[model samples]
Target: MKFFKTMFALSFITALFIVGCAVQQPVQPIPDFSPTTFNSNDYVSALDNFLIILDASSSMDDRYNGNKKFVTAREIVKHLSQTLPELGQNAGLRSFGHSPKVSDKLTVLFYGMEEYTQKGLNEKSGLVSRAGGTSPMHTALTAAREDLKTFSGKTAVVIISDGQEAMGLKLPITLEAAQALKNQMGEDLCFYPIFVGDDEKGMHLMEEIANIGKCGFVTKADKLMTGSGMGQFVQDVFLTKKPMVQAPAPTPIVATPPAVEKAWVVGEAYFDFDKSIIKPAGFEFLDKVVDVLKSRPALFVKIQGHTDSIGTRKYNDALSLRRAKAVKTYLINKGIDKNRLSCEGFAFSKPVASNKTAEGRAMNRRVELYPVTK
Candidate 1:
């Protein structure tokens, strides 16, 4: 009995010590909200051209939870590139603290000012590896200014950072560089700064950077972890359609002619990513299309299926065809004559929107209904 008690006491003490050690680790608090999807296409018109200025400083080595700050940042940027609307605009990726030994070195532009492609952006984003040395954020910003010297339209300068200035640096030059860039670009430039970790000073610094650009805004990485949050961010940035105020004078209404032109706008049936089966909402949409097709029996309907630019052309071609078949089957089940529904898979060949963007790709990945009048 005495031996058993002694062994139990020792085991209990060992367990307590182990538990204590585990408790000493820093705890990363979970965000208030989390949702699954944050597809970038939902917010289409954020910017025509932009650069993702990623911080690769030594500070990113710190752990937010179990994951490194730099790792989280890389993932965020990768996802951002994947989802961002690619409306055939120029975009690029630039990194700071990549070359620590070289002080005078400018920020490296791994991507482009060329037509933005999701795959290209992702490849560039992945180029950033381990973080080292001081944060040369201002220098990076200056280099970015130079990079955009040739760009004419409104540009988005997106900086992802922990907000730490260069090591042992006294006065920060971020605001100065930002102002310089703003002056050069005028109203045509916007700055969006995202905080990678919960650094109060860093958040403040980022907010200041955002303030420098009248058109830009500040955000936190955590805020966009969930799909809904990401959607909200995209909406605020892209879907920039302003609300209309009621005018004192009402607009005049025009009456329609009895004989309308054969020109019919058949709304698109959108497909979810890699999905051929129509959703409940899509089915409802098809109901209206069915009615239109039934009313105009003389009109032959063409169902063209298309895929986004993510997959190989051959694979996408097959996928696109499957989508068209799915739509055709759905329509046939809904009492539409098989002869009236002619389906064709255009794949990614004939894209209405640029495949470089999420929204553009979303627009492209659809079964478009066009009335064929021979």
Candidate 2:
């Protein structure tokens, strides 16, 4: 009777409540994009190294879209790692403002400056599982300087965060640290800050930090969630196309050999910090240069040495000269006529990229080879 009706009503309400509670917004899926497979003959590595700075601050604990921002950030990094082609680039991951579950420290270089591998990066990124601490971004940036201290060549710093600081009190200090890293690394470094969440302030802050490197760009996590977007971002930051060299078409058999275009010109050679000794990669490249010179006895080469904006002009001038001489000596040993090889040092002047970033500085610290036909 009435009691039975009451029980029925209560049961119906309970069932409705349970149903309502069970219904949840479906998690957004990570979209697919064509995966890039890098071919050494067709493409070259753009960045020699990269470091990812992830924000595990409390603000990232807040929900964004359908999930916690921290979860989204973690997935983004993992996806980015997968999307990145194995380019022999050095990679590292640093997480800041994470809870005890993630790490006891305020910041941790959880991954590497070691050779990049998708599985390694994804596993390390997953370990940063919780977010519950004050944002100490400045400390992370300052630490990044140490993380990349020994790495040479072009580097990219990827910051994935909601861009919120602890009460915004340390924002300026964080910016200063980023600037210091840029100044320390010079043209050899760039920043790619990926903003998570929809906070307008966070987006702006990320943009400013990216601007500090002068060469990087700011992106949103939503955009990067898609496969195509991630592919483009990874390619833009990590790769450059190899110059296309067209071979001559076959002709009728002739007694005389056909003249060939000068397709074997060497571009530039890089040096290690403060050292004129050729690096292993430099030796391989210079061996190619030796072949080109041997093929063209009528050609003379002008080797111009340059240095980054690190030391005094006088010291750099001497260093640059030494680097030039090192290259000249290599050519002579390979049996190229020393009389046909001329070299000069430009010190820290005539920069190809801004001396304010590590990658730029690396570019400046090089020897340009110009081949002239006698």
Candidate 3:
């Protein structure tokens, strides 16, 4: 009788363990925000011709967040190139760093979007040689404007640098030059100055330029590069209608099918704060998900979005959904069937880590994608 009791007790404990493993709290769904929609064929005055003027001055070699300014700028350009197709945009490249004299002429690394698409651009072969000097912001802008004159479509000039103008040209003068170009090119021409590193002077100058050019100003490099805010900004600038650009069309939302047996695949996708897009490093893990999907043809996955308990729940929820859908869209673009994937947002309700510290919050704000057997 004692042996029977022992066996029964063991079985009870085993059953509890199995039940514990099986029971999972339902993850709160993230709120979905309406995204902007635009007609693909409409001539909405898009800046199809993007001229990137990189400040390759010696000062750009300074380190920010453990990476050199020039290096970070390069990576940002590469990211834009890879992601531009999603927005139906294209870009060209030029730099002032190759000049031997501080006043030397700016070098055109890549002429236009067509060249960028056909030949491809690389740091070693395409970037201006590291013959560093002062930043000739005015010269670079003027040269870019001149190069863009022949092109008929809308044009945008983006300057990426630490804001130190090599030619000793005043910020006001540079602003005037950009404005003059805008006036010449008509209101369709936009100027965007992206200051690398946390230089107050450069940021201020960029703000002034954006104002004068009547364009958008992006200050926080990390945030501007990664997150939903950035995605929205891209949509506004390229896709939206009205005086303000509209958001991109929201991804389709599907109800969870009762017949499907779901299995959670959770992992953290890190991003710079106040941003909703994935970084280049995050893409490697996404590649793994692609591999898994390729191997398991019978399984379908649902992506759950989460965020650190920061901002209001409403905002977090919306941001989380955007991030999750962004991942799903990326996967689909890589050839995954759209029908096999579903995404939902959980916001800050599912906190895997404390939001008290930056590192913890980084871990908490992530997109979890797992397989479900239907």
Best by TM-score: 2
lDDT of 3 by residue, 1-374 (tens): 99999999999999998898676433333223233333433323244566778777778866676666776676556555443433334556778765464335555444454433523544432446454666667776777667777664456677777776655567787787777778777765777777778878878877777787676565455644563544555455544222223222222123222222544333434644446787665565677677767777887888888876644344466789988898898899888999999989987788777777665776766777777767
- Sort every candidate by lDDT, greatest first: 2, 1, 3
TM of each candidate vs. truth:
0.55, 0.63, 0.47
Candidate 3 lDDT (Cα, 0 to 1): 0.63
lDDT per prediction? 0.71, 0.79, 0.63
Cα error of candidate 1 at position 137, Å: 0.5
Which 10-residue span in candidate 1 carries the lowest summed lDDT?
Answer: 249-258
* CA RMSD of each candidate after superposition: 14.6, 10.9, 29.8
Considering TM-score, which of the candidate structures 1 and 2 is the better prediction for this target? 2
Candidate 2's C-alpha runs over 4 A off are 1-34, 168-170, 246-374
Better of 1 and 2 by lDDT: 2
